[model samples]
Target: MMAVALVLSAVPLGAETLILGTTQVPRHFNGAIQSGIATMMPTAQIFASPLRYEDDWTPRPYLAQSWEVAEDQLSVTLHLTPDATFHDGMPITSADVAFSIRTIRDNHPFASMLAPVTSVSTPDPLTAIIHLAHPHPALLLAMSPALMPILPEHIYGGPDLADNPANLKPVGSGPFRFVEYRQGDHYRLERNPDFFLPDAPRLDGLIVKIFSDPMTMLLSLESGEIDMILLVSGVHDIQRLQAIPGMQVSDAGHEAIGPLNWIAFNMGKPPFDDVRVRQAIGFGIDKRYILDQMMAGLARDALGPIAPGSPFADAGIEPYTYDPVRAADLLDAAGYPVGADGLRFTARMDFIPGVPEQGRNVAEYMKSQLAPLGIALELRSAPDFPTWAQRIATHDFDITQDNVFNWGDPVIGVHRTYLSSNIREGVIWSNTQRYSDAEVDDLLARAATEPDPEERAALYARFQHIVVEEAPILFINELPLYTAARAEVTGLPQSIWGAISPYLTLDREP
Candidate 1:
């Protein structure tokens, strides 16, 4: 059950190279810092000992040969494969695995996922034990995805590791190793000489060319400058690129089955503190119009916290249709009257400047829908991500547009966005709405540790029900899946879990 790389008849494997294009370049290589690590280090593997991950997010054997969960399920022990070695010729060890977990928990900027871990212990040279303060039913799922990237802690520790050039030149124990990085131009990687697997990566090296715009990137793909187009930001661009003659389109569909878009209301403010105003805002958004016009009908209109494909997604939570009379009636009842300009006295929305063109389309649609209800929607763009984040934390805007990314677990969306702990230290990424509900929190606590599938599903469904009724955030449409590869590339099957298509498995066009 392994894939071998093959080449076009005339091209030799060692001489073959593949070029990849993406519309946007990631800001950093640190996996925790951003969502782009899997793109950058396609060959890298996480160091979760015996628990290896397959493409479908099921656990298999990788650097870790195998693992066992104690009968109580309170702990898990892993055995590392002796064959595995880092690119620097260091043998993979249990200490490295322990250190990797600690590094992410102690120093990684995005530690929200792993903050629950109490301790990691290396009882022997080849085995590591993870003791949990509480049994996590989602542990297997978390270990399979974002929370499990393995690092060589021996290299990444101390101030030197913190400031090391190796952050960019990552010597991963994957199928490929970083070769060269030309700022704003291209980053290149070659086959890892230390790779443990046999009969491996067919291509000689992989080149990731960064194009500033989608049109340029698509053109590069057609001209053979780039072999594949990784991700397109909007539906219009996806359609245009698919029309290109030789290129093949693969639709992976909605990357995450959780809420992708949410229209956030600042509950710390006056009107939003009232559930009626929040519900009015929800009813005012013409989601169907936005999905049809802006997203080319490629978007799924959402009704609750979970998307349609999510296991916990319940259809019973009804969405409010755009009825101007109903929207205006709710606004009037909330004591917001039409002013001299025939606009409800509403405040402006703050959005990050230079946001994808889709944000502008959404804002324009909101303006049209709210205008009929006599609501004035002022759209203002902040300078950058940090600036926009700062404004959001300070509750400097009445409304904002945000796409909450989560991997189907309700806790990822529920706790981070509406829970009380997220409001700490002027840093509010998830909980921008400042929403809190005692009953919702109680349901969340129950859902977190409840192992019974039926029970947890019931608990989360209740939480989602409360969230929809309270309406702190306006649920928006989720995008349809799409991935493109030149006709020659092979080995990719459609995945249900939808972790960004594994880059290591992609081969040269045959």
Candidate 2:
């Protein structure tokens, strides 16, 4: 295997370093356990997947040189690039690929993402064949960098995988190598000279600094202490940040299907179990007002769980309009008549962390709107993400507000939010709503294995129709994703997967 040599300018006294800021610090570097963008941003640099998504959202080769699907649509064969090597200078082979697939299938939180995959076999050092229980049309798309990162078998193949100490210092065959991680401070990575890609990563090193607040992080950008913010900044701060000289704000570098923030009811609990009560709550809150006031009119009102832009979205279904009078009638019909206390019932809403201010504002707005209908809505906020995740997963909350990303495709994105099999206890963000329907399950299953793209889309459309009619979760609006950076920074590629790739592609000139 040929190795690429580090090409540093001899005239430069030191290597060029790029520093970025983020509000959330990664709990660990392992992608199989964590799904947050905070974890993906840093881990993207340290690990390489067999396949990657292009700017246009098409699957392309990375570690794997090429792939072919069988005519029966039940298996796929992958050919590895001969030049790929791990950070430790070991050749990356088909065995490592097989190990990573089995590990992710057995241990990953969203293992259902690979539910169709049955087994992996390697006939030689450069080839990997994957067998599937059924035809999965979206298998290639599901193998994007974030979902299927290739791990060094020597380090992660032992027992107690999650508890392994090497998780904090991951070793992979990506363009960059992990250096050190200072908790709550920053994480660092250096360029990999042995990377298969020839002279590709342009930057010498990368540093991601952690900030607790958005304002301080924006200030760091202005003072040149940081080059960019990995995650999108709030819309309220975008204008102010743009007004600063030499700064640019863009909403372009995000995944194709953005996240949808909505109100979810625990169907396993009371009051919410009634369809009329769920519909009453949906009509009580004004989605238009929330989109205008809370979201700064930067988002479009969601018609359903799927984004309107996606082919699978059911455009014929209309969204529930703001109607308190109708909401009150529905509540009364559901047998919760307004009592002498001027209230039908009381409930609390737990706010997820990512958008605290917007969440609280929307909660207060809903409280005021629901008051006229004789429904008391209380607002509750968790101290951190873990607390909030635990509450929602275990069905501990009455009603809650959270966001779900469709991750480019509904098969890989919105399926977990509604699939009954995904309702695992204590598992964060997997069908926490506890919704189950025989018809809906049938449609989802058919869509997963349908080889024809048009037929698959039709099946998803039917699924959306049922979900919207059932009203298990109230669809609010599509959240806009963005990334802010200084003008001097160049060569940053636009991404539909939430993070820029080819870490070496970025450069900041003083």
Candidate 3:
């Protein structure tokens, strides 16, 4: 195993192919506008970002060779790799960088992510200067692989931004090139010979093998048919898989990709528009039960919107304790008395599609939990991710089970959920709750540009207190899993992006 230049060895191209098992089926290859692991897993390999975030939240160069922030902190200058080119062999320039930023500003679901950016100016072929209206502390972070993937202006600079045919056949300037996606079976990506980095992306190819069932996917890993499986959704099977020999199971490198499983409400509606009703329902769910019984010792209680271990998570917020009597009393106070048949009301519940791990199981558990307490729920299942996303985007459903990420910074991930300005129609993962408060709005706006860490944290602390009390979304236990990989796999991505990153150094030994 003689290394040539750190990431590269003299192994033959076909010697090392990484087969990844997943239950996730990606809707598209473009991650510029799309969020989450489904699209992100492929996008990070096919397309490269200006920078990638290390596990410690530090920024390192990816496509951009170097970057510098101005003294006033209102702008960032990116010096891209001179020889970087898309899969089609077109040189990557500042124009592409500029276009990508503009596209992201207008179309990205996190509408508030680039709210401070006024314009991007390209002075030279390799230099891009991003000018901000305010001091954006998360500018570099917003350019991370999952957050932003620099799209080639030549290929995608056409009529429709989000609805182009080129989306399916992506041409990117990363370490890998898109080969083919055979709908139900698998999506494959081959190594890019013309990659910017010298002797990088040690793998010959990467294949995402899709499974209709979690059991089948796990079986592939057990039989050595697949090299690894990520986002292992079946919580009950984690312990069983961890005991298998030649397999490594752990939840490391996911610190910044904070996923919280919880109930989100449609505040645009009647009973849910009432805060008392919302709080009553929040008081009904037992976060402890979800962790102890459901999560298989894989999760912690995510009491607030912010994930635990984050520097900004407030430990002092008064938790909504489990009190069915109080819930009943609150329902009575809110003018919804239990009927003669002992049912207060029923609302439709939808869960994100993929598998039962996300919202389906949680919705079923909540239905049982809330039924005895006089509230009835109608569980609605989305056949796929797109359908589930569409329902949330269109503001349909009384409440839904969802898994959302806090991608590194409060400005990048947390702001869009609470900011009133981000309540855009037909945008999944935006302010879909339809909640708006002038004070919460003010705090988020200030925190977005506030450079001082203590000041931004204080602002977020207040934001958490207000949202938790109002109960637009009830915090539940974190979505937990043990991603299993073969012991032969080395250089697995240790960044915050984890399994979804480019995995440039990933290699398998014979």
Candidate 4:
């Protein structure tokens, strides 16, 4: 049975309860400070944003009732709802919106996202005008439910932003309130009766059950124990869940969070520092095979950082086709020759620890594929996600497998990983490869502020061509992420942000 402790006393009789399942563990409970599915999925419900998104990528009013862009495109004026109040009964005002925007810029991993914002001027308690240093075409996208969760300044104004007490015990103006969290088990949330939006959050409460084993979670879903499972990546299980009688599985929700899984090189290292070596490695591996066989034809081959689904993606860019002979020749030209021991060189390969489909299985496949190129591989194992993240952030591995996202726009997700200016130490997702190209940086900079869409796209195409040649990352298959839910679960989020949206209309059949 779904946990009813939170729903029983708080809601009226016959109110429905929502139960979700996930294997991923969050680093913390703040979406404004953290990225990725683990934290964003849950925190997005607990903390609301100025706007929510629809499946067509249309911006819908949420906490902020209406907003208008300045005629010069240098500022965005937000008119917040006067009735919106945090869970603690504190009125959410324009000041909180200003504070939240500034906080996200300073602490969030997407370094270039809010960097253009000069300041936020609060003309009134209901109006906040965001002043920008330049025209930011993707600024509104930065305020999406998942990307920007408005935090209460009065609660999170203390010294340590990351270590704030309110992160665990959050006080927000969202449809839900953080009730409790028991590690390695479940997270419970209660509906906020005083929510700003009327007739919102049809469900009385929510229970997110944490499972170490996804198979068990699937079985639970089959038995009607779990109402839904967010970001389900198990290939066979996805098919299995789809075939079940009373279950629904679809990847429609993740258009904004464009996920791609590929191999990342530490450019600070010797062998990977050479473009030929990286290119050789790319040529050695069969991307088509990974997409067709390993991924069960669920994913499409990714050529560059921009998602294939994005309007900005350049299909004209050259791709590294499977050619082992060419790969060996390049390796030979790079001064590595097969020794009497039958190996030309040795390298250590690591991967993100969770999800066997994307982790150990792919790493082992890479090891086997590279073995034919006279490369002896040592597959390094991480005990958990945090350990692997630390290794990547510190640039401790020679080569590793990684999964990244476009996050609705290139400015929010793509620029952070490729820009030299964002090569911040200890930041996991920001330029860990130490890649620095003035041309690439300049192209990205120009694209971020360019007013004309055509000019912006042209600049991105140029960036893609240069970066693909540099080969800091060997492009692989785009991840096909899905959300599995029981048929009874209605009003499932259909937005580009997917499971991370503020589900105000979530309901269940009696």
Candidate 5:
């Protein structure tokens, strides 16, 4: 009953086709933007080597044959494999490596990931030496996704590629080539015959199908129209997918699932501008109620910015508990008084419904908590994504439901959010609360420059402590990252780091 499309009539075997389903095409393909595409096209090798492996959340080599660090741990040198080549049969050189890092810094798209690099140089044709402004122990982990996904220097000259023809149709060194892209619908990729890996990328082609709604995507999976779904909608979505017959489910709980959901405050605004108010709000909401009523008790309450599974996560810091009396007292001390109508001064919280049910469910739970403290809680809902983005950028409301995309590294996700420079242009810039603390910024800066793992962890712990006490945000549930595929697919390894390789050894049942 399976529909197999044969692309090569000359090949002895039937062509393998895979239909991959997702809620949306990636927001950005730049590795710095996110890792969705890299997971799908693993055949593309990087110069620095993968910092985290598919099996473990630890670092591993991909393109770098071997690497050595100075005794002072200030400089790191990477030697490229002689046989490693791009999809176009171009031997990747040290020049290409230097260009890749330089491009990331010059271009704004990769600013999030590449801003930490102090300098990159090539001492030899096949060797790359990178120097950081200071010792960065986590530099290896930070480079894993962005710096490792090396781009050909010749493709886009050291400038913005927004208007470049390559942006629409990119040519990667990955095992797959971009065949066709139907905007807002689906994109097709064909295997690269010139791929470097041997006996890799078993599928002849891959089709990434985007659905407007989860129900339609689920129906496609039930009807065998698609082989798998990438992102999970919610806890119930996982339950529903598992119920489907003849399907395999892979769920790597906390680390892969990403950070717990939380509420972001517009710290630039009044009331929340006060640390006490922020702390009161953090203590006011009963996380247990939301867990039971909204998330179906699937998530654990996050104690701090770093989730529990992270290596840098600090467990000694006590988590804030719900106390209505304390919340009301804090509100009173902050100069907000309850009127005759019993409604204390409160601002409207803006939330966008990703799926119709999720918005209404979470908003109502938040409303219940505020009502008890004599706060006039109002909900402003946006039905779609564009509208939501606009509202958050303009700081149109008091608070919003948001989640940080943590790719196993704590610094990449948390540090930027707490930085002040990122709060410009109305967009949250990851700093949803627009929080600006000199001490917190100092800790983050020191952590980035400190190459010692112990020192970095200590600095980060101090930063987390400040945020926890200030409570600019309320920590929420860490959603599960899951993969549901057809039973025939094999050799696809399970990973907690969230860096999956679809091109690795997966094959269909004969």
Candidate 6:
């Protein structure tokens, strides 16, 4: 606890208020029912999980003072900190821990992350024992705030937890307390007086301003109307903002482990069903050009679903280099020759919005590049994120541009993209491509429970090889996540996951 107190000392008391900007408004405050960085970023500050991950991706205790795993790996027991209390003044107890674990296991979009846990039992107010059906190597990592936000049992333990009114006005046991939320405007939070950590949350309050237009958000940051911009601006804007005198821009150390953008083909649809067609499209697109011209060299060419920096990434795999001639050959050999109209097939390419014009630029580039191979790609744009996600969930497009934010572990992040069981209707952002392989599924399943680190890494390496060969999605590039703030802001956390939780330690200089 002395180390924790030392970290809190970085933010002095005089640093009173902080204002941040975002393009996406939170749809709900409940972490269990919602799935997106927009919602998670805000809710993370309001709730306290038993465990969290450090920048190195190792588990660290938060609400739970300490924990132990049985030698058989069948159960884990957590000891809670006696002094911790929720924002509502209720003492945090083992009942809240057990309730949150069970609720999230049933409702979260990545519920598969907790598939190993069979039940939770509370022997006392400060003790919770979790029973597992099998060994799960990454269980602690999965308990990070992003995956398992511990909710108050009294507030969210009802039968209709998802529809609870507390979702709009949340109360939790974190360093911040909810103050107010004005839809499409801003959400405000103040420091939690009863927060267990001493001299924490140096800022008196936090304000997250919502702006639909990214340019407006940038302007706000530049004008000092907003002190920071969290996750909205693009790389191009970030580069420009860095030149300003009082602004500070950095990737926050997430470039090595961020989301990789790709073109996901609907395997349930025709043309995409053919492995040759998928391979042809992969070879046709010039990812290097996209990285240079469209991305401003802020991204790296990705050959597989897992980024190169991850432990599970396959070093032997190579990206499908840009070869239009080979692309044409594959299309012609597949019996789709150049017709009198000089077109092999016509298909629509759907683009997800909120990418700050990069999505449209990439779509246009793909259209021009694919034309030489006798492919006609009609561009379509979804009005908003929800509509765009629905199109992906329903398999309503031929090809779509999408990305997955890897949750530090492949089991929680990469598995959903290719797992056969994840191809359910209305489940947005999973394996909507519907590409399934028995061997790959088995590897993913085994990797989840493999206790040995080397053994788990080997399993995922094989899984990566299989997915790359199948070409379910056209692996593109890993984009760097940038955060720009005033020079006065300091000690902000930086990582692929828990991007916003650093706000707890952030302090502003007057």
RMSD (Cα, Å) for all candidates, in order, is 4.6, 4.8, 4.9, 2.8, 3.6, 5.2
Off by over 4 Å in 3: 1-13, 88-90, 160-166, 336-348, 378-396, 424-427
User: Backbone collision count in every prediction?
Assistant: 6, 3, 0, 0, 8, 0
Q: Model 2: clashing residue pairs?
A: 201-504, 202-504, 255-496
lDDT of 3 by residue, 182-291 (tens): 77677888899998888889998987778877887777788777788886646767887888987888777776677778889999998999999999998897766777
Quote model 1's TM-score: 0.88
Question: Candidate 2's C-alpha lDDT?
Answer: 0.79
TM-score of every model versus the real structure: 0.88, 0.91, 0.88, 0.91, 0.88, 0.92
lDDT of all predictions: 0.66, 0.79, 0.83, 0.85, 0.65, 0.80
Q: List the residue pairs that clash in candidate 4.
A: none
Candidate 5, poorest ten consecutive residues by summed lDDT? 3-12
Best by TM-score: 6
Query: Candidate 1: what lDDT?
Result: 0.66
Which candidate has the top score in lDDT? Answer: 4
lDDT of 1 at 268: 85
Candidate 2, 469: how far from true, in Å?
1.7
lDDT of 2 by residue, 1-510 (tens): 000011122212125777778877788888766676777776678888888775666678898889999999999999999968899888899999889888887876665667778899999999999999999887887677777788889988888788888789889877888888879877778888888888767788877778877888888787777788765647677767768887877766555446787889999888989999999988888888888877877767788878755656777887788898989899999999999999899999888876754566667788898988998988888888799989998989988888887866777788888888888798767888899988888888888899898899888888888898789999887876666788988766566665635464677676
Which digits, one per residue and each the tens of the lDDT, describe model 6 over residues 1-510?
Answer: 132124233433224767777887898788766767888787678888888655665678788889998999899999999979989888999999999898888888777778788999999999999999999877887676666778888998878887798999998887788877888877778888888867886778777778877887788788777778775437778678978997787765553235888889999888889888988998998988898877878766777888765767778886788998998898888788999999999999988787844577788899999998889999998889899999889889899988776766777778888989888898877889999999999998899888888998888888888788789888777766777888889867675463645356788766
* Candidate 5: RMSD to truth: 3.6
Off by over 4 Å in 2: 1-15, 308-311, 500-504
Which ranking of candidates, highest lDDT first? 4, 3, 6, 2, 1, 5
Query: Which portions of model 1 show Cα errors greater than 4 Å?
Result: 1-13, 23-28, 32-57, 197-199, 253-259, 339-341, 412-414, 493-501
Which scores greater on TM-score, model 1 or model 5? 1
lDDT per residue (tens digit) for residues 398-461 in model 5 = 8887766554565556676788767755665467677899998888878766767788889888
Which residue pairs collide, candidate 3? none
lDDT of 6: 0.80
Which of 2 and 5 is the better model by TM-score?
A: 2
